[model samples]
Structure formats: structure tokens, C-alpha cells
Target chain A: MATEIVFYDIPSSLPNKAWSPNTLKTRYALNYKGLAYKTVWVEYPDIESVCRQIGAAPTRNKPDGRPHFTLPMIHDPSTGATIADSAKIAAYVDATYPDRPSLMPAGTVGLHRAFEDAAHPLIGPIYPYCLPASHALLNPVSAAYFRRTREELWGKTLENLTPAGDADRVEWKKLEDGFGKMDEWIRASGEGSKYLMGDVLCYADMWMAAYLLWLKLVLPGRWGEIASWHGGRWGTLLQNLEKYETVL
Target chain B: MATEIVFYDIPSSLPNKAWSPNTLKTRYALNYKGLAYKTVWVEYPDIESVCRQIGAAPTRNKPDGRPHFTLPMIHDPSTGATIADSAKIAAYVDATYPDRPSLMPAGTVGLHRAFEDAAHPLIGPIYPYCLPASHALLNPVSAAYFRRTREELWGKTLENLTPAGDADRVEWKKLEDGFGKMDEWIRASGEGSKYLMGDVLCYADMWMAAYLLWLKLVLPGRWGEIASWHGGRWGTLLQNLEKYETVL
Candidate 1:
């Protein structure tokens, strides 16, 4: 029997919200593997209880001494296996569905991890730049929850945290430079090498695609420019994966 | 008859010199692939002429209009083919000797290229810190050539180009932080993943191993601490590739 994978994600306030980058990574991986899976939408506040109710493994303890919870968790009904963490979930999908496409690829887990490690930092500094737009996308309750939690984490109000006017431009330039280097990397891999892993859609592509997708959803007006940067490399890479966009 | 690969390298003044990281990459690839290869040592001045005579393709011209010639070029006697550029040479090695061990894992050329692109920059800023020690190891003739060319390239004299005292320490911290991220990446890949590509060796491992080897070669007295950074992670990765250090 085909395993019915239950994918979990945080729902934004928007009527037809896209998956967060973290959730999109797992969702994309499942789609790439051609697995039969269904989404289980969870509100931001209920993530902990839902995950715990489903018996998902706790990631780590937070500062408050409570077990940390995260989205993009999965439950495989056939095996009765539950996996949390996007990376681990991808690994599980690869392992369980041996006949499906491998997300990490054979003997590339370290490089894949390193690639992710390297890419995340480059993309991280830009998150605060999108704060205003991101905050607007969240539902009222979730927005309040996000603000309270993020303010505590960032130690700044969202208004003060988000770069304003000219500062925002500088931040965008920094992000562009980071993405530009990655674009050059993709091009230099080999002649006509399109995807991050070269000519094939792999997990790394999904990671970047998810990030780009989030940008598209949160900062609609800015997406055009960001996509156009690097000779439309980022946009085309995302476009190429249209076939793999299964869950909304 | 097996093809004999002619490995090109810049000769240093030191008696027991190792190939530069650029050259070591290809050399390591040849060794890893178990290919039969012999070193062809060329002085800095003769690099252009030797490569041209061997029919290797020319790199782009420098701003000063001098045609750039680089090492780690290879001549395959059996095919009468000469290839320049370490990345290209590695790719050639993988293709020509398909039955042997692959330098880049299958379906990972782009990610491998990207990983390399990301890594090299992290290690690049450390080059200036090693300048004084590097110049000391070069032959007088090559040192003169290196100084003139690098000064023109860097717009600073070799002595002044090298980071001094406090600047050097800051550079070291930057390098450590870069490598620390990479170490976290390696650990996060899986529970027991040791090498850059996870457990098994690949081109990325060779790239890092080559860089670490260069630090050891150029700064003999100082390589100890740098290798021991990140809780001996760098040392462990280099040690893991002990079997692949064949071309020296």
C-alpha cells in the first residue's frame, strides 16, 4: 500500500497563503519524490500540541525548558513513523521511499548539509529586511504571537527591526550580492548546468526555491527585481520546478 | 596502454615543496582516480610558455594585457589532449576514467561546484595572512615573479600586503568562523558523517585537504594551531583523506 504522508505546516492569515520556506522544503521534497501525501494545516499557537499529539520527536529544549517544536513534521501511516525537522524528514522520505527519487543524493549528505549551511547564512541577514511585509501577511492572532516572540528574540519592535527606506536598499544589495555569488556558482558548475545539483532537481534546489517562493509571497513587488538579478537565473530555476509544486 | 597524465605545477625554491592548492586539486583527483600521472615542474616564468607549448587553452588576459596562464594543467598522452584549470581537469579525470573512483559524486557537479565556490572565498581571505610565510618558501626567481605579479594584482607590496600583527589575528578569527560554520555543516549532515561529502571522500574534500596542505607547507611552524581549530575538526577531515595523498 502506498504510504500516506501527513505533512504539517503553519497557516498564515492570508486567505490562500503559501507554505513557509521550512514547510515548503519538505512539501517540495515529498512532491519531488512523487509520494502521496496530504497537508495538515496547524495554527501557529497549536504547533506544539499538534506535533506532540502526533508523537513527533522533540527537536531540542528551548530556553524556557520546554521541548522545542517546529513545523514541516511528517507522519508515515504505513510505517507508523513520525519525523520532524526538514532535513530529517527529507532523509526519512528518501529512506522510506527507496523507489522514489533521493532528496540528498547518494554520498552527498555532507556537501548538501554544507551547501545548506553556507546558503542559509547568506540568506539569513535579509530576513529582517522583510519584516514589515511578513508581519502584514500573518493573521491578526498569529501576527500578535509572531511579534511577541520575535521581539523577544530580536530585542526590537518590528517597526524598528525592519530596515527603513535607504537602509532597506542597502540590505537588499547585500542579499543580492549573496544571491549573485550563488548564481555564478550555479552557472560555473558546468556548461548548461541549470539546477543547483546540475541538470536535475534535487533537495538543494528545493531549499532555494522555497526561499524564493517565500520572498515572492511576502514581498510581491520586490520579487521581480530579485528574480531578475543574476541574469534571471533565480527566476528560471524556480520556474523549472513548477512541476514539483504539489501542495499549496 | 594506460594514459599518462602530465601534472603541471609551479616549482618552489624549497627542496620538499608541495603543489599549490590549485595544482593539488588536480593532482589529488588523479591520485583519487588511481590514474597514472607524472609531475612536470615549471617555474613561474615558464608557466605561460610551457602551457602554450603543450597546447593548453589560454585563460583570459589580465588588466595589464598580459595573458593569464595558470597551473594544474594536464596533458593526457594517450589522447594527445591537454587541459587547463583544476576544475576542468578534475571533470576530465572523472569522465576519462569512469571505471575508477569519481571525484565528484554522480548528479552533484553543480552542488559540488557551488560548494567549492562558497568554500574558496572563506579560505581566500586567509591567503594574505600567509603571504610573508608563503614568500619565504618560494624560490628567489619565483618570489620576484610572484611579488611583481601579485603586487600589480593586489595593489600592495608583498610585505605590506601580508596582514600584520593585530590584522593577522582578526583574519584568523574570520577564517575560524568560516570553518566553524563548515564544521557545523559536516556534523549536521548526519550522526556519523565525517568528510565534507559525508563519510566518503569527494572533490570537495580534496579541495579542503589541498588548502590545509598548503597552509602546512607554507607556514610549517604555524600550521599546527590553524589545523587544530574548531576542536580539531580540520585536522580530522585532513586525516580522513590520508589515503588520497598520492601525487606528492
Candidate 2:
């Protein structure tokens, strides 16, 4: 019998038990591949210790130059491998479980990576608006940890992280323009295109859908606005990937 | 006989008769597709006039808001279509021919565009060094025009556009790192991968090879130096696509 993969995720106080887009991407990948995985919930403060105990390497060095551990790691007993980072986890699952459908189609792993890199500008501008909202959703312990970490990065209070009032709209508009450019490129798929690669749902779609889901969870009103932009393309994307939104 | 596509190019006094990476990209598409085409060389000063005369739409507006005409345009008499811009031209050729090996394969056009967008930072950082070298290769009329125009954009003389000495090396290193990141992403292609789409050639590969070829043309010394970076990946890529480097 194949052992269940041990997936690690951060718990949000939200009833759905998911919030971080980073971990949501992995959850979607596991569910889409029909992999049996049991979630191990970790708190913001314990990420480094949990990752260290399990032997999953840190994803990157923090701004302070220390190894920075992150959630959305997986320990696959099937291969006795411990992988960290959503992207690496996706690749590992796809490569190990060849019988299942691949999130990255043949010869497209690089293109998928490129799409995600290009997508950073699309998703990044929305971060300031999302941070305060996201910090609000965390439990007390994580809320404090999240605020301190993020505030340190920006050198400001969480409340001041994003521009307020009309300025926020201008900032939000930048994201809209970014999405419009992305939509323009993807529309080269011609009409009725729902995903980046047209019909098949690749890792890039999972990455995108994960962020769309994050916005829906934390910033509902703004999420509603996003749905109207780009001809409801994003709304339709979330709808299509609804099956993989399973919280388990 | 089918009417030939009119390919617009900016000529360099270099023995090869091709210098601009932008134009080289379109030329690669024409050759790669085995399309019938003839070059209509447009000097730097003549670009806007030639584009206006042919009714090829201006690619974009200039800093002062006037329509900015740039090259690598194609006028297909067979279809009576005038396409401007390298990417759009590449798309038009692939879409119009229908019989040639597609530069963009099924379901990959959007991915190709995304890859190109992600590639800009990689290609852009190298431009400062290449500009003066490129101007040196242009004929006097084009050289004067190129200097005046680019100086207007940078508010600096052609010779002063790029950093010199140790500073230039530092600036050049930024490009090396950008290419390294791209190589890292594409290395997801796993072992023995030759192109962005693994074994098959795609527009992204052509897009990259065009710049690689451009660097080789104007900056032979630095080009030779680049061959050693990223395990000779750029060099090998150019070597693999050598067949399509033909000047027509």
C-alpha cells in the first residue's frame, strides 16, 4: 500500500482551514493528482523548527542572510524524500507520481517556470493591500509573528504597509493593468480560453488559482472587483479549479 | 508562384548585413518557417516614413506621444496584411502560413509571450553595453540618427550611455545573473534539454537565439566570454540554432 504523503500547511483562523496561497498551491496539486495526503498544521513561529526536524531544506535565505524555512513542504514516505517550497513540491509530486496527470506537461516545465516568473509582477503589486488583510486573518500568535516579520521587511507598521484611500485604488489599478497585459498574452489562445495553456490545467494555472483563492478568502470585496476585470477570466478560472479546492 | 513576404530590416555595415536583434528575430522566423521573403532594408531615419508609406501600423507611441515606428515588420502581399513588431510578425507568419512548422506550437502562444516578457530584464540589462558597439557598426547616416535619438532617451551621449571600466563589468554581471536565473528556470527541462520546449524549437528559443546572435555580432569579445557562463548553455543554444542564422 502506498503511504500517504505528509503535507505541512499553516492554519488560518478562517473556517475553511486554508489561507496562504503558497500552501494552497500544494494542496491543489495533491488533490488534483489524487494523492493521499494528511495535513500537518504548523504555526508561523514553528516553521523553521518543523522543517529542520523533518530535514526539508530551507527554501531561501532571509534578508538577514539566515536560512528561512517556509511551509507547504511535503514528506513523501513513498520515496523517503523531504521537499520544501510549493514549486519544488509540485515538481516532486509530478515526477514521483508519473501515473497521475502532470501539472507541467511534457517539455513545458521550463515554460511553466517562466510563466510564474512573469506572473510575479501580476501578483506582487497586490501584496501591500493583501498583507494587512492577511495579518487580520491569523490567530493571535501568527498575527503577531506575521506583523513583525512583514513590518520588518517594509520598515513600517502593518497598517501603514499599504497606501490608504484613493492611493490604494491607484495601486490596485496597477495590478489590473498587469492582469490586462497577461490576459492579452494568454488571449493568443483565441476565444474561450480559460487557462494559460488553453485546455489543460498546468502548474501555472495552479499557481494563479492559488492566489485568486487567497484573495477570495482574505479580501472578498476586492476579489469581487477582480472577477469583473479581464472579462471575468479570473472568476472563470477559480470556478474551473473548484474541484481542487478541497480543504482536506 | 506565391507572392513573397516583404521583410523590413535595419542594415549594419557589418559583413553579415544584419545587426538589430529585433529584426533578427523576425528574420529567424522567416527562415525557420522556410517562408519566401525579400529584405527591404530601412535605415534608422527611414523607419517611421517607411512604416507610414506601407501602412504598417506603428508599433507604439514615443516618449513625446507620437506614433513610434520600429522594424521587423512584414507585408504579406498574398494576404495583403501588414504586420509590425517582431512578436506580432512571428505570430502572423505562423498563423498565415498554416503549412510551415509552427514557431508557436499548439497551446503555447501565451506561454511564449510570457516567456518573452520574463526575458526582457535578461535582454535589457545588456543593451547599454551593446548600444555604442551597435552604433559603431551602423553607416554614417544611421549612426548619427541612432546617436541623436538614443541620447535623447537617455539624456547622454552615445559613448556615455553605458558605464566604462570596472563599472561596466559590474553592469555586465547583472546580465550574467539574469541569464543564470532563466537558465535555472528552464533547467527544469531536466537533463539533455536543448530548447525552451525541450527537443522542439519554439518562438521563445528563437527569441533568445536572436539576442545571443546579436551579442555575438556586435560584441565578439564579450560574446566569447558569455559562452563560458551557465555551463556554455547560451553558446550551445546558438550552435544548435546555427542553421537558421542565415542572412536573407
Candidate 3:
């Protein structure tokens, strides 16, 4: 029997940015493995209710309460297990359906480590750095809705969560500095390789693709030039999502 | 026959900080697998000789040469392949020697994902934020020595890498914010288990242990206290390292 999966989604928000990466990753893994599953996209503010159904959110009744109430929570009805954390969700989807082609390669620690290094930078400050700037441009109604949802999930105001005062300026500079580092890495990687892991499209490509998607939305001006350069390397990676969209 | 592995190291320096984590991880894997190899600790600022041998550094003849000139580059003499990047090195060690007790677990993706998430915040601004402050505190002679070694390896000054501008302050704030988020993760992860993976140790524990060691050295006072608190719970996860100290 096919496993049933529910993916809580927000209509239009940055936290949804976190989900998009894993949603695409999970969908890719499912399709690669040739497994079948269903997805449920919950609206913002109401995701709390969906989380309750899966027992992944903090609750007075449950013995242990999780720290935050973020979305991209996955509920496996078949096993009655609810998992949070995007990468964890991707791994769960891959492991539960092992008969399919493995998204993670066998006997390749270098591959796994590369994925870890690439994924970590995106998850830490990079995603958070992009959020406020992207959200600032939203219409007042959408912005208010976004802020309210963020507060509920993070248990703090978005302003407090962001790099404030001098810190904010420094983070922007660091982001700019990172572009040079990325450029250096691309040049060193050489032109012939199809993916970061050579020929096979691994998690590194998926992560870079997801970040590029968010970058495109949040920093369209910068991303437009980046997208055009290198003869559409970033564009090709973004379009690869078609392979994983079925799981979504 | 065991695979031949060579690690380039410096006795005392911060860039050498990269070596410790990679060494610790590879050492544990070697001990777990009962593999044997050679250990060579090169003097600081003198690794240029070693880099020249491996074709990793720049010389007058080749100013912009090789992928990276960073310390702790590994040469797999047997395979005639050279690999850098600490995480990638660890993975290669594990994959090349399959008979070892797996640093990662089978049938679990949550464990692997948790390890990646936990390790990411450490390497980003968290560790880099401490550099300038440490450099400022050191005496001129010592600071000069430290800066020289950095320039030799990275081909850039630390000041240029992390400027004293407003942008640097923002990076610090982002790191400080990360400390809070990590604390929350530690508190919330107390969900009826001691380790992140629960019941048994995994790669997450090893990665955290290695980071804790670096934190103790760089941000000694506060990070030491935090490390002790979490270290108490995860200490056993690292006990296996005692047998692998020779390689480290």
C-alpha cells in the first residue's frame, strides 16, 4: 500500500520558503523511488490546526512540546509518525520507500558531506537574511498577514528575529561577500560536470536549486543577472523541479 | 590492505581549527573500522611545501592555481585522488572503508538531517564572528604571526575576509541570534531522549562534539558553559574517540 503524506503549506510567505525546498526534495525522492503519496497544503495561520492533527505541534495535552510551530511538517498516516525539519522529511520519504532509486548514493560519504555543507549555509542565516527584505515589498495586507503568521510560529516579532540595528547592515554585506565565494566555487567546479556531484543530480543540486528559487523571488534584480550568466546553469537547475513536482 | 591516507596539519593556529574537526571525524571512523594510516603535522606557515607537493597552493609560477590552498587537504595516495572540504573528507573516509561501524545509522533520515542542521550554524557566522575579536585580543607579535599564516593559506587578509565595518557587526548579531536558536533546539530536543537521534549515538553527536571543541578554543568562556551543559548529555556519543586519538 502507498504511504499517505500531508504537507502543511502557507499561501504566500517566507516560512513557506523552507517548505518549498523540502517539498521539492521529497517530491523528487518519491518520484525517483516511484512511490505514491498525497499532499495537503494548509493555509497560513490555520497550519496550526493541521499540525495538531499530526501531533507535530506544541500542545498542552502532549507530554513533550516542540520548540517552534513551523510548517513543512509531515504526517505519515501509515506509520502514525509526524516528522518536522525539511531535510529530515526528505530522508524519511526516501527511507520509507527504499525500493525506489536512491536519492542518496551508496558508499559515498563525500557526496553526503557535500550535501551537508551546501545545505547548512542555506538553512542558517541565508534564508533568514532574505526573508525581511522580501517581505518588506509585500502589500500592506499581505505583509500584516505574513507578520502575524511569523509571530505565531516563532514566538517572537519578525523584527526581533531579523538582524537588527548594525547587525542588519553587516548581514547584507556578508550576503554580498558570499556571492563572490559562490562565483569562485563555480569557476573551480569546471564546466563539464552536469551537477555538483558529477553527472548524478544529488541533494547538492536540489538545495542550490531551491535557494536559487527563493533568491529569484526575493532578489529578482540580482537573481536575474545570476540566472542569465553561466549560460543558464541556475535556470536549468530551477527547471529540474519538473521532475519532482509530481510529489508536490 | 588499508587505504593510504595523508592529512596536512599545523600544530597551533585558528585555520588549524579546520583540521581538528576533520581529524576527529576521520580518526573515529578509522578506529571504528580498525584502519591504519600515517599522520603528519606540518609547522605553521610551512605547509606551503606540502601544498606544493600536492598541487594545492599558489607559487610565483602559478599564482591562481588549484581548487583551494586551505590546510588539512587530504591525499589518497592509493587512489591518486586529492580531496579537501572537511565534511567531504570525513565522508570519503567512511565510504572508502565500509567495514567500519557506520558513523551514520541505517533506516533513519532524521538523524542525518539533524546532524546537518546542527552543524551548519556552527560554521557560518558563529565561528567566523569570533575571529576578529580573538585577533584584537592577541599581542601584536602573536597577531602578526597568526595573520601571516592566514594570508599564506587563504591568499587574503582576515580583515578583508571579515571587515570591521557595520557589516561585520551584523554578522556577529546573526551569530548571537543563532546561539538562542540552538539553545531552543537543545531544550526542545529533550523529548524523552538524550541524543538528537535518540537511544544511540550518530554523526550528529560527533559533529556537535567537534564543534564544541572549536567553541571552547575560540569563545572559551560562554561557549564552554554551553558546551558542558549539552556535552553532558552527548558525552557518551563521543567516548569512542579515545581509541582514535592517534590518528587525530
TM-score of chain B of 3: 0.59
Cα lDDT tens digits, model 2, A139-246, are 888889999989988889988888778987888888888888778776876677777778888888888888888888899977888987888988988998899988
Off by over 4 Å in 1: A1-4, A36-38, A46-69, A75-82, A121-129, A148-180, A222-236, B1-3, B48-67, B77-82, B124-129, B147-180, B188-191, B222-248
Candidate 3: the clashing residue pairs are A109-B91, A167-B170, A170-B167
The better-scoring model by lDDT among 1 and 2 is: 2
**Runs with alpha carbons beyond 4 Å of true place in candidate 2:** none
TM-score of chain B of each: 0.93, 0.96, 0.59
True contacts kept of 2: 0.85
Encode model 2's per-residue lDDT on B67-172: one tens digit a residue.
Answer: 9999989899999999998988887888888799988887777888889889897777777888899999999999999999888887888878788899878888
Q: How many residue pairs clash in each candidate?
A: 2, 0, 3
> Model 2: clashing residue pairs?
none
Interface RMSD of each: 2.4, 1.1, 10.7
Model 1 lDDT tens row, A74-152: 9899999999988888878877788988888776766777677568877876678666567777777777877888888
State model 3's lDDT.
0.54
| Candidate 3 lDDT, A35-108, residue by residue in tens | 65566655555656667666784422322453446556777778877877555665566567666665554432
Off by over 4 Å in 3: A1-6, A12-41, A53-68, A74-77, A80-85, A103-144, A147-204, A215-223, A229-231, A246-248, B1-239
In model 1, what are the clashing residue pairs, if there are any?
A: A13-A139, B13-B139
lDDT of 3 at A43: 51
